[model samples]
Target: MGEPSAPGTPRGDRLHHPQLTTLVDTARFHAAHSPQVTAVVCEDRALTYARLHRESNRVAHAIRATGAAPGARVAYLGKESEHYYEILFGCAKSETVLVPINWRLTAPEVSHILQDSGSDLLFLEDEFGPVLDRLPTAPPKTVVRLAEGTGPAAWTAGHPDTDPALSPTPDTPVAQLYTSGTTGLPKGVVLAHRSFFAVRDALAGAGLDWIDWRAGDIALVGIPGFHVGGLWWATQNFNAGVTVASMRAFAPREAIDLIRDKGVTTACVVPAMLRMMLGEPGVEPDDFTTLRKIVYGGSPISEALLEESLALFGSEFAQIYGLTETGNTAVCLPPADHIPGHPRMKAAGHPYPGIGSKVIDGEGKELPTGAVGEICLATPAHMVEYWALPGKTAETLVDGWIHTGDAGYVDDDGYVFIQDRIKDAILVAGENVYPAEIENALERHPGVAEAVIVGAPDERWGEKVHAFVVPVAGREPSPRDLHRFLVDRLAAFKLPAAYEFIAHVPRNPSGKILRRALRDRFWNDADRKVN
Candidate 1:
């Protein structure tokens, strides 16, 4: 495996304190430095650094009152709000692990996570009260309702607003985020305090500004906190002592309005959110004038969409690619490489300082440079393990390197290009066909808005390529037109054998394309899922 350029030595910065290694330390440090500054603002409620520190302290006491031991799991089921941050920090302060559940999950899904994690307490938003009634079994031992004048504010009222002074090492587990469960049941991924701050520490003086923070910069957390992207981004900003304006929920119009009203300087968003914001009615360049930089990822973005977003927002855009297992971002496509037609725009970018990435063949041997194989990552931010699943953990985290199931390769310059998930690769007559390549090509057509590629069982060839296309408004290109457009760009085996035009593609909350949902339809009755 080819090694990327070595990361620079660590250095200290005015904003970063060497003594502050944990989130609890960051909370205390920022409180002392920027006490009056607004730390987090959600909806109509806001919390200053001082107030946040105090309230979170009370929450720590209240959680301890419930008898939750250190390392105990505490789950939160709710939309983003100021209370969410309090609970997050409180869990950190009290030495408990915070597990943020996806509010969009069904009751059964929610039940499985809560039960599987063995959460001792649950903080539920009043909006989801009915979810408890629909659950398959009993809920946690302690359920705190978040409502007007009741939630954390009331529960923590009697407790002293002072730091618990609990000591947790840098490696202490603090957050437990679950996987998407695309293959099977979701497994809880445990992360320690070091996971959140390792990259920053490593890149302190690396002089690479792929993603940087500044004083007085107001950041928008458009992605929900339940996802590692949202939580990690928010924590990074808080560590920098800046104001963060989080949305109660991501709505295209509201996100635009928030940018205009709050003068949001930077934001972390997925490509879907960018597409939706650009498509919002009456959205103009002025609506995003305050935006100086946008960090986007979660899925590959089309060239057309990237150009449109750049022209409309007139902001520097950076693409980050990583999984929750890698503590959100292991690589970043810097702003300089974001040129509309640049080949590097398709690359997943070089790894951050101190991150190790390599491509390996099926036999567990490392592949040479420019060879396509499974991409693996070794970083300080790697997860501790999948909660309660030693076998699954062993299979994924081997010898300190995460076996990222993504199929990709590294160029001579160290840029990683992700093809598609290994399991998502279609076999056509013993040849490999990656859907991302075809999807990228299809999306380049003016008449096509989005395309999803899947493998369908075939009588002759073991598997055939099937595509679901979403046409641009007022334009529907025929299958022949699509084929003609892709003929010169893709190989014969990579081209879609059939096409079905649709209105929109189904995506999860974090904006990942649900390939399994569409692929399963073609193989429901097959003797085996694979061709």
Candidate 2:
């Protein structure tokens, strides 16, 4: 008989195999090909590919010395930094899973993750001392603070000229990225080495071919490192032998200046960050000339902002759509979509090669084109499983397909248009009103700066469509005017029953509207969690 495939070996197709075990190989590959090339750039430090490889190895050895078993979870709680990537790569080298905690999370939320993951060690940035203090119990293992004087100096030292032994298997768990959990407590999504690398290949296939990601390209990573955008993008650049400019904090002006001063070629941001950058005082055209590609997602962008951005930055914008469970983006709206008259420009473009996507009904049967339903995908980048949440994992993943819970419709031309969360659908007087459609219409109004629509309870109708709006600077359009603006564009039933003006809308770090927070104000005393 033929030899049985080893545990974690690729089955049938090597291209679709998992990557939990090959972290060391990836790190070593960059080290050999781009040793002297800058791999990471932080506020006060720079690391070449050789340096990142060596330092990651030292950190891996340190983790192993702590008696952490292979596959043990190691948590990193901090803002974005070179140390974050170092620890991530380090944990992967030692066959340990790295879990990055969202810096925006509250103490209670952070406590939940640390306890749930049963992390063997917690590496924290100094700024999070207060959050760490709120933990009910110390993490199960060591707590190493990333500061000037804490722990061994070698742990934080940058390696400029040393090579450490590489040890990683393809199936080893590299990371466990937690979902944002807008509806409930977050779940950790376990990603193998292969799944992580697949994202890089997917990016390349999605029109990032112009990236020139050899040892010369400088990648600026400004998003939160805990989030998939920061973590995955940084790793992709590193693997491609590109330098990474890591920002510890996100300030729009500083970020813009960094792009100009550092010769940064690539960047990733959400729509809100782009809005902020455009609104920043003294912001001039070509301020981002050094940027080659501006990858954006986590929320939709209006056509108005899209046109303004195209005028401001030229043709360098690409939209990506995915979640933590999918490692990163499974589908990309390529730069070509920015071209005028492109049919899919208004939609989320096609799925990446090697990724299968479909819109499905409640029965899991595929829905035909132009039908709105849950968007499901089968991809090599899907997470292995959710940590400590078997039932939840089972519910989300089935037969290699990950149910996205996001409501979207595929057009006859194969373009996908996301509507709203299935859970957030507004049922008003027996009519279905998606908040995104309303919000998009409201945003099209010249006086409306930003808008969020939610379903508020009503006696006559099951629920009422309520809109919270932020007006543009020096532009005050009353509720009636705004209503008149949308009257012709939307169905009469979809109009907002009430309007409230707010200075700003609540959002997560990723720029996603916190609808649950908005809904909580009205439904705090309700029986169920959501309406």
Candidate 3:
């Protein structure tokens, strides 16, 4: 990692606080100001700020009854719901770290996280009970359902509405988000309340209005809450005391309906979701009249699709750039830069206020302007560390700077441009999917001897997973055969889009796979570029 670059335009602004403010205090603050305002809304439930604050206290008291110590892990396995936020705030009040698992992961993958976190208690959706049964080792923690009248709900009802008033410091961790490990195992990226809250305070304190949180925004949350991007977006809205219209998952038609019916004014979506919405039935430019801004990230957007969306939604488009380790987004392409034919359209915009970044060469020296190098950024939003992986943490977070494993360059104007991913992790439809994980799953098949996974350029999703397979001695594996084998073993998004049969998988002399060589075959066009 490189040393911090001089604070540029946005960085000149100073942080306002001497210490991090607890998220529990944030809830209390909102309740005091907007007691009757809608805070969280799901299918048929809308929780007011006062109710949300009181209920979270009850949840915290109930969780305390479970014998969970401070900083103990409390895991949730399910889709987005009011219950999710309840559990989130409840954990915050109890000083417990919340671990939101990716429900799309296979049973083994889920079990690995559960085992690693050693979570004291798990409050999961009833639908996920079968998945838990598929775990190789029975999880030893207490499991409760996240439903009304369940054991957990009954316990919460028995607790007082008064606050526990547990004192938690700014350094206290809030969540542990697991990133798909490039080496075939997932590693937890631990974030504190300061990781998200402090950054927002600093930006607003500096008069950064690109993400100005305003009341009556009516935000639509279509991103999966398991990822840091989704979680931070939702929290940003709540921090501003805005009404949040939550979605269980992103469905094109459902999003359109929410914008039209719920009068949603803003949303945090991915490029693929924008593409999917264009094809949804009955969608027209006027359908999104209520929407003012659409902030998208996780994958790059094609110029053609951006043009279509610009005309259709008639809403300002902003691009965000960051990773799990940086608390979702450290840089943003403001609405002013979204102009047609603008040069900064491809730029990731300047570093957020108070964010420090540098483009550095392999020697750890800052590169000259326009020189492609690894992007290193430091900010209040940066995660504290990789959970329990001190060695990996030391390698990634060097001297308080997070070495983003992305190759990029900074222009003289201070705009950053992302060129490629240095790490072999593939982003599929905004979700990080590593090739090694897919290859490991493929090798388990009897008909497959060896496999190499690569990302191919895709119009909808920024990249699609492509597999090159070499069959075992006498078995020739067809695409259908391999697809059938992986259907239940992996998430649908991680399934290979195309398969090529070869005699052997390519590797270097040292027995390491030359993934770039294999990946280059599908990305030969000069026109192919990602933000």
Candidate 4:
């Protein structure tokens, strides 16, 4: 056993400590150092570090009393709230892995996750009561309904609160995050204690100071806790002794109001969410005065949007790039890179200090600078393995590097410029076209609001580029007009062969455009996989 260190202290000059493998240590550290500080604030309720620790302890005890084994997986189906954090830490302390179900998933999808993970117990909010009742499983292992009061109300009344003395093994699994799986059904991404701690340490070493993490500083957590971004960001701030203000759903007006009224200094959002915030009619340049940092990611930002945000928020912006499999962030474009004149501003800054990343070809050969290829990553934060999918896991995690199917090139200065996902690349008339590049060009057009480029089947060409566009409010641009506009901006071959105007582009809960969904609609009758 190792002595408990300060919350933000780097362990042994390494990004992750080899011994501090349990997430419970984060709660313990805060309980010892800042017991009285408010650790979570949701709706009208609040939990100090001490209160949170005690609550998590009670939950852990209850979980164990339910016959959950040390390595058994427990699923949490709820929105962002203090209870969510409590259950997360409780699972950690009890040596159980938590599988947080995305609230946006349908009943069938949720059932699939539950059956796939073989979850022994489920902690669900009252909102999901009907969904739980509809599960086709028999006797349903155990279900706990979360409410404002203490003892189980409405569900599992006889459950007892077990003691908080359960000790976790260092290598125990802590969390199992389900990947969005654009190509197939979602697979559970297993994350061990070591993997999570590695990410926490790496984030701390990123050199970006979080204002809301200071004593009495307010942090607004609007992102869904089901995603890695929300879960880890809230956990990190809690460990640092900050007051977390959470919301069940993200409404731009409500989020802005929370920041303004509650003195929120830090927040995380994806590009689409930020765009919505910027679109709010009442928003002003000074509306975010208390905001010290706005961590944005999930997709690249347009240069125009970046400039506009910089003009409004000053220099308090940071861009992070990574997936759930890599534990939230493996690359960070820090605040300094927000400088418009900085050469790396357009690039995804350098790889995080301790994270190993490279641009490689299909044969695993390292590509030189300025060469576009697969972006592979190696880090302690890499996921343990995909649950029940050894073959898929072996393919993705080869020789320790998690091959991120994203295509990108590294510049001479070591800045990474991601072109697009390899699987998302469209072949139009035998010409390779990256949707991101075409979308970027289309977004530059004044009349376009949102655009998604997908490959549609064609007899002449293997696949043709089909663009689904959402035009600006009250301004509809003709397909021919847009085609003419793109002719000069992009290669003629990259222009969309057909165009369809839609009210809105379909996106996943995390705001990633559901390109696969769009492609599926067009290829429903096709025999091929890549349409």
**What are the lDDT scores of the predictions, listed in order?**
0.83, 0.71, 0.82, 0.72
Off by over 4 Å in 1: 6-15, 148-151, 425-531
Error of 2 at 204 (Å): 5.2
True-structure RMSD for candidate 3 = 3.0
Error of 2 at 1 (Å): 38
Q: Positional deviation of 364 in candidate 2, in angstroms?
A: 1.5
Candidate 2: tens digits of C-alpha lDDT, residues 1-531: 011111111122112212323667767877876678777888767877787787777788788778888889999887776667778778877788998887666566678789888897898778878888876667556888888323234553553323345466555678887763433455788988777577555544443442225435677776677777777777777666668898877788888888888888778777666767778898877787777678876655556677777776653777777777777787777666766556566576556656777888998888887787888877788888988878888988988888887788776545567755665756553334568777877998999999998887664344689999999989979999998988755557678999999999999999988988997687777533222
Best-matching candidate per lDDT: 1
Supply candidate 1's per-residue lDDT for 43: 70
Between candidates 1 and 4, which one is better according to TM-score? 1
Clash count list over all predictions: 0, 11, 0, 1
Candidate 4: residue 372 Cα off by (Å): 1.0
Q: Write the per-residue lDDT of candidate 4 for residues 1-531, one digit (tens) a residue.
A: 011111122333312232345668778867877788888877667788887887777777777777888889999887887878878888888888899987666565578789989997988777878777766664247877775433232342344433376667546778998864544356898987766566555555553342224545677776678777777677667655678888877888888888887778888877656767788887986778888788876655656677877776653777777777777777767666676656666675556657777889989899987888988877777888899999988988988888878788777655667755566756442234567767877888889999988887664344678899999987789998898888755546567999999999998899887888888777777433342
Ranking by lDDT: 1, 3, 4, 2
Give the range of the ten consecutive residues with the poorest summed lDDT in model 1.
6-15
lDDT of 1 by residue, 109-223 (tens): 6888999999979999999888877888899999998994345887788999999999898899999997644343667999999889977776564756667777788999987
* Residue-level lDDT for 339 in candidate 2: 66
Regions of model 3 farther than 4 Å from truth: 1-20, 148-152, 527-531
TM-score of each candidate?
A: 0.80, 0.74, 0.94, 0.75
